[model samples]
Target chain A: MEHYNMNLTLKVWRQKNASDSGKFETYPVKNISSEMSFLEMIDVLNEELISEGKDPIAFDHDCREGICGACSMYINGRPHGPWHANTTCQLHMRAYKDGDTVVIEPWRANSFPVIKDLVVDRSAFDRIIQAGGYISVNTGNAVDANAIAINKDNADAAFAAAACIGCGACVAACKNSSALLFVSAKVSHLALLPQGNPERKTRAMNMVAQMDKEGFGSCTNTGACEAVCPKEISIENIARLNREYMMAGASADK
Target chain B: MKWSELFTSSIGKKWVMALTGLFLIIFLIVHAGINACIWANDGGVMFNKAAHFMGSTVVIRIAEIGLFLGIFLHIIQGLMLEFQNRSKRKKGYEVPMGNKGSKWYSRSMGLLGTILLLFFILHWWHFWVPARFIGHEELTEIEINGVHMHNMYNLMQYTFQELWVVIAYVIACISLCWHLIHGFQSAFRTVGVSNSKYMALIQNVGIGYSIIISLAFAMMPVSMYLGWV
Candidate 1:
């Protein structure tokens, strides 16, 4: 197999701060190996910018692989580039051809405001998770792990829901900027488990209420969130969230 | 926490859309059933009698006001939501995924709604103004055993004979089908009827209702166009 190299033009969003207006700045990177990941290609451009003593483009990343999901970029009009259920870190350069111009931008939802070039302050997500993402952890002797016999299907579904990495890709992909997928994933993961049963009602209600407070738009079931979610979290999780919230609202503790 | 939050909040707005949408759906059912009586082929006797009762009855007259208000509320709230959703993304993608990401009608609800609104205005112009305000003096009046009634069936027959009006109706019914496809199940979801066991049932019911009701509506004109009735 012969190695392929491409010279690409990058139109990257450059934002000074959260309050600053942003614009796209063009940069050219040459001789990029097709095998390099999309982020690694960006690294080459950052290296050149640093050598010239210019402020390098700022972005977020942790694991180079897809799991961490710290890497998020709206590349060429898509969250995580033009790939099915992939993170930006996992996108390889071979997806592009020589002389192709790639446009990169930060997630554009007001709820996930831009912090700098291609990086957004997704802390709103943290607040939503903080609202009710955790289960009741009673301070006592450690409970036996296998004490609760969980059904296999429920456990599998819960595990699938738990795979979400809080990437905000769902918000970026949603036309409404809705956090339904992320909130649903968190809600469904815990709602399916016995440990989560105690706070199930409040958890569902509070999480949704928090999500609403964050100014995220409503979910219209466009399925774009699931389409772009690296975890492939199902729309079924959203349905379950609605179920939980409804049950909570109708519950009468008085 | 404010009372206004029930209409302004995202979820509250959803509640308004859903409740108004479902209420309008009930109105559609009753309206469709009554119109279906035109198929009785009894020279519009039963249809005219039913129309007379609906027009003359005070309870139904009061409910008609609620129906009109519900429709207006649904339209206004839907426009607000559509604008809100649009404003959420101030920029457009360089390459939209289009149907690859979501259904066309899902994203085009605002556009479909506008079409429906225009169609509805035309609908009211053709029938409602004539029946309620113009005194039905010019309309063909019939007596069924000495009971006075407007021959609404003749009104419909005359209305549907025009090809353009029939075409407009067919297009309007198509839009209604797509609107109901998402709206029906979505309304239920917003109201918290999202149980997995029953959601499948609800979805099927939604699709079934969309197809049957829209087709029923479209057929009214198509049948008249073809002189089937």
Candidate 2:
């Protein structure tokens, strides 16, 4: 493949803080390599802004390899851009052409408030995880793999559900701003395991309760979350979450 | 933790929507089946007889209350959901990828529901009030095997004869098709039917159900207007 260079117009959301009313600030980047990742393109832009004696745009990134789930910027109208099953950091410049205008903004949901420019406080996810997205198992004693016989299909579903990186892309992509996909993925991964049995009764209820407490919208089953999900987590997990909630509610003494 | 939380929470609100929505789905099927009897072409006697039994039946009369409740709860929850969803995003994208992002109906459920609401009011005024409250004395009442039945068939014929009413009904049914297309599978999904195999089955059934019910509904008025039924 021949190496190509393109000049692009970047329209980015600029906010001084969560309290500040934000606006789009446009800048022109010249001679950008086609092979650079989307975040890398932003880096180049930031470097330019810094050299021009201006404050660099703030965005979040830890594992640019698409593992951390930290790089969640809504490119254009689609979350994580027009790419499918890829995060913002994994997006390449080749998806765009010369003279194209790229609009970038942070995840838009009341639950995930904007902390700075492109970095929103996704700690709501953390709060959900903390709210019973776990299991209690004794450690320091290595058990045989055969100790727990897991079904092949259930194991695969668990693994797939576990692939959720806690990124807010699912929320960003949702039309209703629902977090069912993310919470369901977390719930499914644990509920499928024998170890997750003890808390299974309260897990879905508590997490969903917390999700509502955080002011996230309800799932309309639009599947936009699954469509934009980097891990391609099945909406099946959401069903599992609902199943868990129903079971918990029916069995709870209260 | 409280019992009320089940319907108060976001997930709970969805449950309310799904359960009430499923009830309406069943109601539509029954309503459509009964309305389809107009095609019997037996001087409207059979249709009116059946309508009288349904109207006089204690079970169905009680069910009418439940049906209204279901519709009411569905509308209330749907509106609340719409408001919450809109508020969740205080700011929307300047360049929205509308259809590219998701199906238009999925995003427009609120609008469709509102249209259906107006349709419901018009529908009740045209049919229910006369049959139940105002009395259907003006129309001919036919007695079948000593059981008197309201001449709803004539009422329907008169209602559907007007082009404007027919057009309104046809438009309402189209809105209903979109609503059912999203609502059917969505209700199942909300209730936790997420397996790939089951999801596909439910989606297919949903599509078929929407098509049949919508076509059945829209065709009634069209058929009446054309004097076929």
* Candidate 1 structure quality by residue, lDDT tens digits, A1-254: 46799999999989899888878899999999999999999999999999999989999999988998799898877789888889999999989999999999888788988888888889999999999988768798998999999999999999999999999999998989999899999999999989889888878878888988888998877778988888899888876776676556656353
Give the per-residue Cα lDDT of candidate 1 at A226. Answer: 86
Q: DockQ each candidate and list the results.
A: 0.46, 0.71
- What lDDT does each candidate get? 0.86, 0.88
Please, what are the lDDT tens digits per residue for candidate 2 over residues A29-107? 9999999999899999999999999989999999899999989888888888888899899999999889999999899
Candidate 2 has a TM-score of 0.97
- lDDT tens per residue, model 2, B57-175: 78998998999999999998788779878899887776775775578898889999999999999999999988878865555576778876787888888888799999999999999
State, as a TM-score between 0 and 1, how close model 1 is to the true structure. 0.90
| Candidate 2 residue pairs that clash | none
Write model 1 residue lDDT over B1-229, tens digit each, in one string: 3345334656556777888999988888988899898899887788888888899988998998999899999998788888888888776665665666788887787888889999999999888999887845447877789987787888888888899999999999999999999888878877766457787998899999989999999999998889988
